[model samples]
Target: MRREFKLPDVGEGLTEAEIVRWLVKPGDQVKVKQNVVEIETAKSIVELPIPWDGVVAALMADEGQTVDVGLPIIAVDTAEPGVPAGGAAGTAVGTAAGAAPGEAIKALADDMVPRPPAEGAVEPGAHGSPAPKEERQAVLVGYGVKTGATKRRPRKAPAPPAAAPAAPAIPAAPVANPSRVEVTAHPVPARVAVLAKPPVRKLAKDLGVDLAAVTGTGPEGSITREDVRAAAEIVAQPEPRPARVAAPAGAEERVPVKGVRRMTAQAMVGSAFTAPHVTEFLQVDVTETMNAVARLRAMPDFADVKVSPLLLVARAVVTAARRHPMINSSWDEEAQEIVVKHYVNLGIAAATPRGLVVPNVKNAHELSLPELARSLGELAETARAGRTQPAEMAGGTITITNVGVFGVDAGTPILNPGEAAILAFGQVRDMPWVVGGELAVRKVTTLALSFDHRIVDGELGSLFLRDVGAMLEDPLRMLAWS
Candidate 1:
């Protein structure tokens, strides 16, 4: 029986997902709960499993195609024998020419079964018939086929000529057998089997590199995407550009904004216009905070955890929020009230390949220093890997963006859609400063706090920034304030 698998909502109530790659192809056998395709939803990249075991009959959607939820993406033949396939329940029903539309699909399943070649049968060729490509089984959950030496049914070699008692001087007329004639006239080229992922194979094809000629550097001698690209660089010549060429008038490239970029743009625009933003800037000597980060790194408890200046900043924000609860709040326009959250869900803005995503730690104010460090590390890693679940991005009371990573000083960061404020951490640099009424060099960094004026007034915003700045200026003050 042929079964069609529709795209399921992986989570987050996603309405659609882009087909990143198809791990199974037509004629390939697949099992129940096998990851047959990888899809990119609005939240993350997910591998979708096939529910029924069968041979893949067709792929309804191509890679990079956006498919809606409940739409069929792959068709699998599940019937072993006897039972008939029908059109209902996602099964494909087919019929011969001049047959009814509801006719049972029996021919498809039968054709899928392999058969032996008859005696004196003509081998598949360009002039005779198209050659049958070898089909290999694939793994349960990955971009590779089943790993092992491929075994193919051997073809019977031509029989040796028998010695006759009487020898004839003239040569006998050719038997004119189609297989022998075609094989002798146009010899078939030997096929080289190479182990490579589908994406790597596509890359090799695009680069015009023969996978068989390129040595693989991956596990089990498998070819990787980098191997294909490197081989392409060595073999493919760069196309020379035409001097002084002009583009056609009114020519422009158009890109469809649909995924994370689209979501980010929408949120930024909404927050920028909807909220009356008040930005407060402060320059603080973070020399003490940097030293504290170094100390934390040396601590036995933080031996396995990654401690950074951001961790100190996050800890400071959480500590300061406890002092000024209004800073950790949202403007409820519908309710005509400011909702101040008692527990801080501190959002750390992370820039990923998809776009800007803020996955927060739940009840950050309650977590210990080490626990907070671990949460921050896990959140960043998950966001970078494009695996941050939708739930991790919700219920953020306040956010902090570390623009310092890009050597940026500071900027007025827009509030995350529902949050009341966002803090931008600038690059810490050695700058001349007055210490004890004398000139001295210190690690100084600028902080920009942008908050929703409707929720947090200037007095509240400044005090919050001052408190955060003070924590960074004197790392010991966090313990004192806490």
Candidate 2:
């Protein structure tokens, strides 16, 4: 029963995963249902488990490789009677296509964890044969396999110590292999980098701030987006750059934008170029909404939720989306069809090292205020942790990008590659405004909604903007509208 482990869809709607580390190698015998590898998706780190007891054959994917969901990561051979497992004493897994065990999969990382190898004596460089590559360690991985269907790892018959200067190899005698061998255990769990979202990482890198030195007030010693901004402000007053080494290349060091950077560049360019973006701006007087947010924080309904203007914006968008269903639609070029989604899978564009990932809340309109808040928090946290699964990022109806949090008025927002619309919220500031025909200080902010004109008309677009502004301007209208 040879098996290969396909990358499973982890949580947070992740479509692809990066192989952080491997736990097993080729030719190692493995038991069923063991941990094989630790993968980092757009959301966070996840350990993959094996399905069958087998010897590891080969690893289909390499460490740091981003593989799509349902793709093979490892191959293993189910231990069988005829299959000769390992050749060398330390050699693991006999050769045949199969999955690796989860527990025995820890490989030599910076932490120096040893993982189990793939099965059957891989004929050194040949399939179904034995090869010894002791310098490199490997781990077995299980995709989605069944339980108790795995075979035990069989140690090889030891070669007798160089007898007579290796005259002739002894004919192996059948011996009952040891039932189990103790594997080196992992001392500590992987550190979860709860640093700021993607933009913050970019901001810190651009500003040359040492992320390691900044003390994070966010949960799990993770730096929040605010932390980076604060550090930037303090340092900006004096010397612009942080105290670091001189430019070794002195004005020349054109780093090539490869890997994630290249992909992000191409993605942004394609989105801006293809999407005929019409950005409609709305400057709302959110004074009443701010008061409502403060009061909501005192209420029992919002006890577990974090209240902010963004929450209100989320509510307003959902409400407006209901009235304007086209906001929740997509423009399908291939089928020559317009996808007007009745439901809102609201996506929040997050910046991370892996690039821009807009993980959305599933069916946002159905949830209550507190649930919505909680969901948003969880989504942000998952995205920051890079644990978000491909599934969480897919099926987005519409999106909200918080340019306001960045203290910017508004940006000509680009549409998410597939979605029809994206809303960019600007910073709420106290500015002089005309109130009752008198100049007064008002907490005013801008809302820029960029819609795909192909699906949404000018009339529909204006109405959606006006409705959202009305809700923010006077939240009481939300009750009447509902």
User: In model 1, how many backbone clashes occur?
Assistant: 1
RMSD of each: 21.2, 20.8
* lDDT (Cα, tens digit) per residue for candidate 1, span 1-482: 66556666665445568888889887899988898998877766778788888898777776887764554567678865534544333333333211321122222222222222322223433223213433334333222222233344556665665864543333256565634532223446655446665557776886799988899886546777779988887786567545966678778666777667777887899899999999999999999999999989999999988999999999999999999999998888898988889999999999998888888999999999999999999999999998887788889999999999999999989999999999999999999999999999999999999999988899999999999999999989999999
Q: Where does the lowest 10-residue lDDT sum fall in candidate 1?
A: 96-105
With a 3 Å backbone cut-off (N, CA, C), the pairs that clash in candidate 1 are: 1-79
TM-score of each model, paired residue for residue = 0.64, 0.60
- Those runs of model 1 whose alpha carbons end farther than 4 Å from true positions after fitting are 11-13, 29-32, 79-83, 86-255
Of the candidates shown, which would achieve the greatest TM-score relative to the real structure?
Answer: 1
Best by lDDT: 1
Scored by CA lDDT, what does every candidate get?
0.77, 0.71
Error of 1 at 219 (Å): 49
Q: At residue 391, give the lDDT of candidate 2.
A: 73
Residue 165 in model 1: lDDT: 58
